[model samples]
Each structure stands twice: as structure tokens, then as C-alpha cells.
Target: MKRYLMTPGPTPIPPEVSLALAKPIIHHRTDEFKKLFDETIKLLKSVMQTKNDVVIFSSSGSGAMEAAVSNLIGESQKAITINAGKFGERWTKLVKAFGGVPVELKYEYGDYAKAEDIQKAIEKNPDIKAVYIQASETSTATAHPIDEIGLMLKEKYPEIVFVVDGITAYGAIDVKTDRWNIDIGITGSQKALMLPPGLSIISISQKAKTIIKQNSNKYFYFDILGEIGAYGKFTPPVGLIFGLKESVSIILNEGLGNVFKRHSLLAKATREAAKAIGLKLLSKRPVDSLTAIVMPDGINSSDVIKQMKELGVEVSNGQGHLKGKIIRIAHLGYFFKPDIIVGISALEIALKQLGVEFNFGEATTKAMEIFSDE
Candidate 1:
């Protein structure tokens, strides 16, 4: 049976990146490798759309998230954390772990965060030093208004540091890191970068750098400044670096604007297809990275997932308390229009086999109509 991977992170790797990873590994410290590494960093900044200093880490996206928390929020400091979904909840935990107090502004799983709410929270707690949030919440397949929130902070709370975990947003969506005034923007290799899960990239503003220099934080491997001056504080993942170079090249070659359009098209087709089949979407403001569909009454999402896997198509179930309540299908990196067709076809078959009543033939047809129209 032919297999398809449709998970949010660890999305299918592009052939160019796979080939680059297979090339002979080089020593990380050599001048030859430094040239490639430096080029990779430059390419990363171009894709991230930021003029601030970008740092690459030899860890998953969460590692960069940790760095943002550790460096910016010192002990006894108050920070505002927006918890709209699973990834948002992580921000609150990270703040507490770093010895900072989190004044959490939480919304329902499918709801989006508003900039006005953040303003009110900061006004209530004038001592708040930082604001932490996600650009797109993966678990809920929802998008927060990062641009509005960032601009709000820049205009009013200029002293408050703004950090955004753009793990599922960077390459998939036009995040506009610099224009958005995001002090720390984070993303992983596995998401929109079309590579394996090993590298995490972050962009830091000068204001954030100054804050880090003054703060006395106790962290070793995740030291953002240490990674900046030196190519890497320790031995970098040379193989992944090579793969990242090729992946970023692919993105830049296709052009970032075109890539974002492609993702938007795919996401629209998926959401429209699901709606055509009488399924409700979980997210009120859905992102282009993935789509979360609410399971019908008396139907278990896990059973549908199992049936799809049996047919060689692997999608994901919802995370945390949402498990067995929703099915998530990824439309991020390395995926095209035809991939969406296959995924939707398999979903129709799975729902049919389980005796869930819906217009089976209409889903793919509607998706095709949208693709053609767009």
C-alpha cells in the first residue's frame, strides 16, 4: 500500500532536502561548513522576513520557545501569556518554569485571542514585563491575531517584550516578523521548512537583546546570545544544517509570496471539502497550516483515524482533552493540491465505512471546484 503522511509537524520532507541530508556530513567547525552555515542563516532571515538577529538551535521548535522564556523573563517578573490552545498553554508553563509569574488570558480551544484583551491585561497588571503567545495554535488549528497584537504592544507598551511562537505559521503564512514587531519569532525545521525535526530558528530584536544582557537567567544550552557570537555554542547538527540550506533554497526559489498563496489554496479546499460533507470545523479563525474537523455525534475520531491509516493515509487526532473529538488534517509544507485530493478521498471512505452518513462524492468534487476557481 502506498503511504501518505499528513501530520502537522514532521510533515513530508521534500526530495531536495532528503538528498541534501544524504550528502557526506562535514565537520561543524571547518571553514567550508561555516560558509554553508552562514549562508543558511542569511536565507533563514530572508524567509522569516526579519532584519533582527536570527539564531539556529540543534533542537526541536520547543527549544527555541524555551529560550524565549528563559532569556526574556527573569525571576519574579510578571508576563502575560495567552492560552487559546495546547501550544498557547505551553507559554504559561514556560513562564512559570523560568521563575516568572504568568497573568494568563485564556480563551476557548477554538477561539482566537484579541489584541484588546491583551491591552486590558497589561493595564490591570502594570508590572508585566513580557507577552508570550503562538502565531497559530497547532492543536486547535486556530490563528491568533499576531500582527495586531504586536503592533498594539509597540504603540502602547513599548517596554514590554513581545515573543511569538510561530512554529506552524512562519513559512506557511506571511507572518511579517519585523513589521509585526515581534521581539522573538520561532519556527521549526519540521513544519513549513520541509525538513526533519532537528533544527529550531528564532529572530531576536535589539530591544530583546539588551533585555537578555541585563537579565541574570540560569540556562546553558539554550543561551541565545552564546549561539549568536559563535556559529554554535556546541557541535551543531551538520547534516540537518545541510538539509535546511536546501529546503530554504526551495522556498526562496519558489518565492515566499507564491508559497503562502499555495498553502492558502490548499487550506481553503480542505475546509470547504469538510463542510461539503457536513463536518463542522473546530477553529473559528482557521490557519492555513492545518484543519481540525469536529467529529459527528456517536462517532469516534480515533476509529476514523484507524480506518484511514489502514488505507495507507495517516492523519492526526486532536490533542489534550480534544482527543477523540476532532480529526486534524495537515496542509502545510511539501503538500500540493493533489495531496489534498488523496487525503479527502480517504477521509470520505473512512467515514462511509463507519456508517457515518454524508455526501461522499461531493467532498472531492467541491474541493476540485474551489481549486479550479482559485
Candidate 2:
């Protein structure tokens, strides 16, 4: 059986990117490499929708998140972290690891953060230095009110830097980094950039740059100040940079608006398909990137995942406390109508094998109907 990948990150890659990566590597010190690197960064800015100086690190998305936290928050300085899911929980951990005081606003697994809550936290902690959040919480399929929170800080707390982890949001969802006043926007190539892991990208506003300069943060590999325009400050991932150019060009050629619409339609199909199977959704404010489906009572999500994998459809089980409780399916990156159909079909088969009670055929049919109508 041909396998289908339905996880949020490490999504399927298109033929163009595959072909780009197949090319032979080049030395990073030469002018030829410089031209490629510069163009790729320019295109990346388009995808990120920001004019801020963007930098790339040869590390996972977590590296960029750590860079954002370590560069801005100093010892004993307060920062507000929004904890709505596993990824949200990571922000608090990163802040604490860097010796920064984390003022975390915890929410229920499926719930989202309110901007007013962040405002209240900042108001209470007048010495807060920055606000950290996720544009899309991958763990629970939730999208926080990024725009509202960014705007609130822009108007009321201009001095506070706004850092957003857009790992699952950048290429998949329509996140306006600059327009929303995001000082630092971070993402990984694997998530929505249609590439494999190992490269992380971050965009920094001038305000963020100034703040980082004043801080005496202890870091070497992820030096944000040293990386500003050094063109890979360290040896970059040359092959992935080539792939980045192709992947970003693909997103731009499709027109950013069309990409956003396609993700929206595919996500709608997935959500409705899950409901047709008598399963509930996990997020209150779901993002178009992926959908997390609630497993039926007495049914282990791991069983469902295993059955789906046997049928050549690979998805993800929930993380943290929600593990074995919910199944996550992706519609981001290279997915289309038929991909969603196959995913839902495999899910139905898996649930049937597990003896879970649900209307089996409706899920696949619902996905088909939505795609056919579109």
C-alpha cells in the first residue's frame, strides 16, 4: 500500500522541492552560493509576509523558539507565555530554562487564549519584557487570537516585544507577521514550508533587534545578533537552502491568497468528515493547518493510528495528557481534496476494526462531497 502522511509537521513535499533537493550541493563560501542564499531569504520574507530581517539556523524549530526567548528575556525579567497545548507548554519551559521569569496563562487543552487575559497579566506584572505565543498550537489544533493580542501590545504595550511561534501557521495559515506587530516570528522548514526538518527560520523586527542588542544573553550557536546578515553565520544547510528556494517559490506562484483558501477548504472537509463519523473536534478555535479528532469512548487513539498505518495512512496521536485520547490529521502543505478523502477513508476503516461505534461510510463520503462540490 502506498502510504499517506497526515501529520501536521514533516508534511508531504511536492515534486518541485524534491527535484530541487536532488541537485548536488555547493560550497557556502562562494559567490554562487551567496546568490542562492540571498534569493532564498528574499523569497522566505515573502512567505513570512514580513520586512523584518530574517535569519536561518541549521536546527529544529525549537532552536528558533529558544533563540527568541534567550535573546530577549534576561535573568529575572518577566515574560508572559500562553499555554493552551503541548507546544504552548514549551514556551514556558524555554523561558524558565533561560532563567527568565515565566508568567504563564494556562488554558484547557482545547481552549484558546484571550488577548485580555494577556493584557491583565502584563498589567499585573508591569515589569514584563515580552509576550510569547503560538499562532497555531499544533498539539491541540488551536489558533490563538494572534491579531488581537499583537494589536493590543502594539497600541498599549509598544515597549513589550511580541514573539510568535508560527511553525504550523506560516505557509499553511494566513498569518500576517509584520502587520500584526510580531517582533519575532519563528518557524521550521518541516511544518508548512514543504521540506524535511533541520532548518529553522526567524524574522526579527528592528525593535526586537534593539532589545536583543542590549541583553547579555549567554548563547553561542543561536546568536541572533551575530546572525543578522552574516549569511548563515555558521555553515548552513546548503541542500535545504536550495529546497527552501523551490518551496517558497511554489507558495508564491500559487499566490498566497490561493494557498490560504486551499488550506481552508481542505481543513473544512476534514472537520466535517470527522463530524460525519460521529466524532468531535478537539479545538474551540481550530486552525486551517490541521484538525484534531476526539476518539470515541473506550477507544484508544493509538489503536486507531495503528490501524490507519496498516492501511498506509499515517497520522498522529495527541501529546501530553491528551495522548491516546485524540487523533490528529493534517491538511496543510502538499495535501489536496483526494488526500483528505484517503485519510478519512483510512480513519473509518481503523475505527471499524476497533469496534468503535460510528457511521463509517459517511466520513469518506462527506469528504468526497465537499471536494466534489468545490
Candidate 3:
């Protein structure tokens, strides 16, 4: 049976990217490769909406997240982390692992962070050097108000570096990196970029660049400055980078505004379908990248996930404490109207098979209606 991947990361890849990945290997040291690499980075900046310097690493998205911490926050230095979901929780862990004090502001899952809360936290912790947040918390399918928070930081705390993990937000959602004053923005190849895992990206602003210049953090592989100085600083994921160039081109050609609208429609379709089927949404501030629907009491989300997979469609179960409680359906990358319809159709069937009481075709019908209206 053919499978449809509707996960948060490792999203479906477009055929153009697949073909680019299958091309014959080329030597990385050659000038031809250098030109291709430079061209790719330039196109990537367009997607990211920034003039800041960007570096790509061969590791996963977590690698870039590590770099943001290791290179800027020195040992015993303090950084504020907003923990709203599983991904936001990573910021605290990363800061601690690098011997930095994590002044954490924890929020309930499915909720978002507010700029005022961040302001209060910074006021309490006067020595904070940086702030870490996720533009879209994948675990809960929620989007924080990064624009407001970034602007607040720039106006109030100009010296504090601002870091954002935009793994699921960069390509699917509209995140203005330069206008938002994000010092370090991180993303991965798999999420909205529509490629296989292996490439991690980070954008650096001049403010963060200065901190890296004077920091003496004990890290080698994730050296941000070293990467900026050296194209990759080591062997890069050549084929993945090739695929990235093609994938980013596809996104740019489509136009970022249109791309974001497509994602917004798909997400609305998914969210409305879930509600039409008598399910509640998980996120208070939902993102266009994905939608999380709360499972009815006594209905295990894993069971719904398994049933969907049996019908040749794959979705994700919630993480951490939310596991078995909510189902996450993705419409981020390489997804169109038909994809959303089929995913909702499979979900409708899965819920029926699980003996949940609801209108059998309501979800699919609602999704189709949403697409037609769009």
C-alpha cells in the first residue's frame, strides 16, 4: 500500500527535490560545488526572510539549537527559556547541558507564551544573556507571538540575544526574522523545507555575532563562528544540500505569500474538520503548520494513529504528558487540498473503526468544503 506521510518533521518531499537528491555525486571542494552552495544559501535566505548570515550543519535541527547555546552563552551565564511544549522544553535542557543557568518560564501544554511574561522573567533575572523560544511548538501545534516578543526584546532589552527554533515555522508560516529582531533562528531540512533529514540551518544577527566573538564555550563540532569562517567547517551533507537547493527553489517559485496561504488553508481545513466531528482543538494559538485534535475520553490517540496507518496514512501522537491524549495531523510541506482531504478521510474512518460516535463523513466533508471556499 502507498503511504502518505503527514508528520510534523520528515514531511513529504516534492519530486523535484527527490530528483535533485538522486543526481550524481560531486566533489565538495570544487569551485562548481562552491557556487552551487552559495546559490543555495542565498535562496534559503529568501525563504527565511533575513539578510543575516546563515550556516548549515550536517546534523539534525537539534544540532543548530545546540550551536545557539554553546556558542553564545558561556559557562554559568544565564539564559531565559520559555517552556510551553516538548520543543520549548529542549531550550532548558540545552542551556543546562552547556553549563548555563536556565531561568525557565513554564506554561501548560497547548498554551502559548506572551511577551509580557518574557518581560517579567527578564526583569526578575537581571543577568540574563539570551532568550530561547519556538515560533511554533510542534508538540502542541501552537504558535507563540514571536513578533510581539521579538519587538519587545529589541526595545526593552537590546543587549539580550534572542533565539528562535523555527523548525516547523520557517517555510510554512510567515516569520519575519530581520523585522522581528531574532538574533539566532534555527530550522531543519525535514520540516517545511520538504527534504530528508540531515541538514540543520541557523541564521545569525550582528548582535549574536558579537557575543560569539568573546565567548569561550567548550564546543568544537557546533562552533557557529568556525562554520561562518569555513563554509561548513567539515564534510557537509552534499546530497541533502543539493536537495535543499531544489526544494527552496520550489518554495520561492511558488511565492512565499502563496505558500503561507496554502498552509493556512490546509490547517484551517484540518482544524475545522476535527471540530465538525465533535473533537476539540489542542492549541489555543494554533499554527498553520499542523493541527492537534483532542481525543475523546476513553479513546486512546495511539489507537487512532494505528488505525490511520492501517489505511495507508500516517499521523503523529502527542508528546510527553500529552501522549495518548491528542492526535497531530500535519499539512505543512508538500501538502495541498487533496492531501488534506485524504488525511481527514482516513482520520474519519479510523475514528469510526474505533467505535467513536460521530458523523461518519463529517470530517472529510468539512475539509472539502474548506478547500472549496478557499
Please identify model 3 stretches exceeding 4 Å from their true place: none
Q: What does candidate 3 score on TM?
A: 0.99
lDDT of 1 by residue, 1-374 (tens): 88899989889998889999999988877889989988988999999999899999889999999999998888999999999988999999999999999999999999999999999999999999999999999999999999999999999999999999999998999899999999999999999999999998889999999999998889999999888948745989999999999999999999999999999999999999999989999999999999999989999999999999999999999999999999999999899999999999999999999999887779999899998887
TM-score of each: 0.99, 0.99, 0.99
Candidate lDDT (C-alpha), each: 0.93, 0.93, 0.93
Quality of model 1 by C-alpha lDDT? 0.93
Regions more than 4 Å wrong, model 1: none
Q: Which run of 10 residues does model 3 get worst, by summed lDDT?
A: 228-237
- For residues 86-205, what per-residue lDDT tens digits would candidate 2 score against the true structure? 998999999999999999999999899998999999889999999999999999999999999999999999999999999999998989999999999999999889999999999999
lDDT score for residue 229 of model 2: 77
Cα miss at 121, model 2 (Å)?
0.7
